[model samples]
Target: MRVTEVVLSVGIGMLFAIGTFLVLRRDLVRVIFGVIVLSQATNVYLITMGGIQGVAPVVGGHGGHGETAVTDPLVQALVLTAVVIGLATTAFALVLAYRVYEEHGTIDLDRLQGVER
Candidate 1:
């Protein structure tokens, strides 16, 4: 694998690790952020799946022999779609967390779950 691939793979792993840790926290906001992190990691993995290219996949692109080393366009499109969905989901989660905070006056999961008098 290339250096770029190695770095991205390591980054994805780290993001997943951190996200998992955050998701286990007692704060709703932190859990939301963790989900966002996990989404980002998934996006990175998608990008890496496209493979690295030395040139664009166009007519007469590179090598002068009509040869080209283009990355998979479909992966790029998928990553873009994932990014937009991630943004929307993150926004919705934040709104929900905000509403929960307003209603219960706390973002902690334990406090929110406790019976209220």
Candidate 2:
């Protein structure tokens, strides 16, 4: 694999690790940030799967040269869709967290659990 791929892979791994750590925390805001980080990692992973070495998928974009690999448009579309969905999901999660905080007066998972019981 190329250096770029290796670097990106490492980055994705780091993101996942950080996300997991944050998600495991007791704070609701941290959990939401974790979810966002995880989603972003997924997006990066999807983009890397599409391959980095390629010309844009456009008519005559290769400068009238010989056969050349074009980056997958489907991957771009999928990532775009994922970004939109991730945004919506994050918004919903934040709203839910806000409501929970307002009702329970604490965003800490432990405190919330105590209140629930």
Which one wins on lDDT?
A: 2
- Candidate 1: stretches off by over 4 Å: 58-66, 115-117
Off by over 4 Å in 2: 61-65, 115-117
- In model 2, what lDDT does residue 31 have? 93
Q: What is the overall TM-score of model 2 with all chains considered together?
A: 0.90
Whole-model lDDT, model 1: 0.84
For 1-117, candidate 1 gives per-residue lDDT tens digits of: 688878888898999999999999998999999989988888888777787665555545355576556677788888899999889989999999999989989999988889454
Estimate the TM-score of every prediction.
Answer: 0.85, 0.90
lDDT of 2 by residue, 53-108 (tens): 77788856466467778889999999999999999999999999999988989899
Q: Native-vs-model 2 lDDT?
A: 0.91
Tell me how far candidate 2 lies from the true structure as C-alpha RMSD in angstroms.
Answer: 2.6
Model 1, TM vs. native: 0.85
